[model samples]
Target: MDPLAALRRPDDPACDVYLTGTVFLDIIFTGLDAAPVRGTESWARGMGSSPGGVANMAAALARLGLRTSLAAAFGDDMYGDYCRDSLERGEGIDLSMSHTVPGWHSPVTVSMAYEGERTMVSHGHVAPPRDPALEGDRECPPRARACVASLVPGEPQEWVATAAGRGSLVFAGVGWDDSGRWDLAALPELGHCEAFLPNAAEAMRYTRTECPLRAARALAERVPLAVVTLGADGAYVADGRTGETARVPAIAVEALDTTGAGDVFTAGFLTGTLAGWPLEDRLAFAGLTAALSVQEFGGSLSAPGWPEVGAWYEGVRQYTLSPEAAAAAGQDPEALRRYAFLDALLPRCGRPGPLRRAVPTIGFRRA
Candidate 1:
């Protein structure tokens, strides 16, 4: 079954996926030798600003040639204008459903990178007032093949159910809960979602288990599909309805920045799911996409395009697979069967075009 077939019908819908969450104007400072001292300020070699949060995933999906729509609150300010223009013009994302509030300020995140790690400071107010167009009886329902959203603790998201009501597959992801409250009260909402993705830490915290695999299994029992991402170690996935499970190792890469890696993985996995690939293949593709993102700086700007995906697939398939090694590689005797789906989807060349200066990023200011 061609999951992407629905996307090709021009009369069907303009967006392949509708994503909703907090959108931040990110100012990423890279190349810091150490954290700033309490008395004195430190210096960074480079800095960049772009849309973050769910925007990261939307950008990733758009970069992969997917028609994506974003629904969120935006302030009528310079930062909001930059984010909206960048996502719409640069990344090809649709924002017609998104709202812009007057007199409200967009969120700003200042991320300092030092030795592959980062310290972020964000400032923002509570959600801005909703647009009158989206109020009462005029609420707009998203039209797409699927919908992606970040889970909010304590209640079922109205958007998730709205999309599902329209026959859109719903994918939900969770964030770090510093409150130490797992808030399993939202588990019932997972029943309305096709998948629930969370990092190992969040999964373990919510499940009260030390093992990520155990957390994944436990989550699967509640949702149709459960995927737990383990940094460096890889990912564990379980399909409750099908009783299928798989664990894929992380693709080795020198990570420059870990920002938005999880978002990129969601984009990649969503792409593979839409293509109707198997569980193992979806996990590997997600891993590869995330590995590529970390090699570059910035959040949404770091997402890999189809070219990167194609190149990685070609490089992996180049390794010679002997009968002995193939047997040890798991079900795929050739060990290359997982990537066969890319044979048709990948373009002839995945090489990127000349870099264009869309944002005036600061680099190497005289100290």
Candidate 2:
């Protein structure tokens, strides 16, 4: 069932979220004990491939039951075909605004996961420019309730402002500034954004604040909402409009791979915001989704759906109900209460069956 079904309107935007960016074919290797030596060949215990980059967030949103539309460039190669099929057929993402270029190879990233951390090596060529005519009758993006923008340090995308002007709430996140110029002024698009989500390191560097919470406060001055993700500690959010602030601790889980966890966090936050969840609930939900993502391998495929969320909620509820189980796990019962809001949100029929997951390889024939 669609989580936002109650919020649906006859005149609502065509999609719940719209995203545009490069989609990379991610080949991931897991279960490594250590980094490979320069001259040594290390065999990984597990491997998987899936669409990554912006596809990570798109997949996450779709899995969370959001109607997602993606605008991206794909190559004519097999990697591109697999990615297109996975997103469109498997994940149910709208790709009408996407395009394929002749002879343009798809971007590829090789990720090695070990000890909850990952090392990535990438190769790709610049994608072809998007054709405005392909978007629709206008030279604008498809109307959406919200859009996620990847803010590059020096380059500001005009579509962000256009989307906002067209009644779409723009949520922006930034990549690392390799130029060493952590000037916030470089991200002019923040003026047109409803929210800005950055990791702790990026937030501190951009705001020149020593603390992530202080950095989020400083950023709230520029954007309506500022969110700073503190990897292990959790996430902090400040609302400039209401001066409401909240911080949620991260869920403790055995992390298999941390790839695309930040993107998953952003998607989770977007879901809660669109659903009109409370501040603390939103942070907790986002943190929970991110926590679930890290327990699996790969990026796009690792994102959790409603069933996974439901399962986790049930497990936690059961744990809290049994004093023995609580003590055995060494988990605080009070910490589990933070997610009691899920009781009202989850389907009463019970958890759904397992959904499709990321596989070790692409291009396998389905029987």
Candidate 3:
């Protein structure tokens, strides 16, 4: 069920969100008791492979019922073929704006997850330059209600500005600055964005503030909305336009792998924002989706769809009804109340069975 179905109009953009970035074939190893020791062979209890990187964000958005359009470069290799098929055919993401470069091979990442943390080793060559004429798309970006931009410090993406100019609400996220200079001024593209989401560390470094909330406030001055994600503590949000601020606690869950959790959080927030949900509700929803993502293996595959969201809502409600159940699970009744907004939203999400997700191997034939 499309969350925006009721809000859709005849003249609205066909795509709900536009994303562009590099996609990597992520091979994840899970259930490891410890990191690998020097010159030792380690056996993992579980493993899975899927499209990662920007594909994580794309899958999250699509699973949440958003009409996601991706503009990316794919290789002609088997790994590339699997990734392209997984996203377009399996996940229902639109790849019309994407292209495959001949002879170029897919980027690959092997991730090891242990103790709620992951270490990744990646290898890939830079993709060839995009030729819009050959790809059969306009030089300008396609119209969409929103777009997610991965902000690289000192390197402004021109497409962000172009999409924003064409009425796309731009939401930006940044990577860690390996240069040791966390200068906010280095990101010129922030001027074109409606919101900026950075993890607590990134936010603190960029604003030179000790507190994440303070950093969010400073960032709000630059963009209309600023969100600082505090991994365990939850998220802090500041709305520059309304002079509003919100802090939502993280949902407690036994995490199996933390990969792609941030992307899932962004997807949930984007959904709530587009639906005109209240500030606190948006934060709570984002935190919940992120919590769910970490419980499963792999990055893009772990993203939950509407069925998962609905099931979680029902489980929480049922558990909270019994004091014994809540106590047994260490569930805080107060934290459960934060997601009460789901009561109104879940009924609207018609019964969709379990969503198909990425598996440990991609060799099995699709039925």
Root-mean-square deviation of every model:
4.7, 1.6, 1.4
Clashing pairs in 3: none
lDDT of 3 by residue, 188-257 (tens): 9999998899999999999999999999999999999999999999999999999999999888899988
lDDT of each: 0.79, 0.90, 0.90
* Per-candidate TM-score against the hidden true structure: 0.86, 0.96, 0.97
> Over 4 Å off in model 3, which ranges?
135-139, 351-353
Local error of candidate 2 at residue 287 (angstroms): 0.5
- lDDT of candidate 2 over 1-367, digit per residue (tens): 5778788989998799999999999999999999988999999998888899999999999999889999899999999999999999888999988899999999999999987778999999898797666656743577889999999989979999889988898999999999999998899999999889999999999999899999999999999899999998999999999999999988888988899999999999999999899989989999999999988878899999888888888888867788778778877777889999998888632324565667787877789
Candidate 2: worst-modelled 10 consecutive residues by lDDT:
347-356
Query: Residue 273: error of model 3 in Å?
Result: 0.5
Report the candidate with higher TM-score, 1 versus 2. Answer: 2
**Per-residue alpha-carbon lDDT of model 1 for 170-194, expressed as tens digits?**
8889867656689677555676789
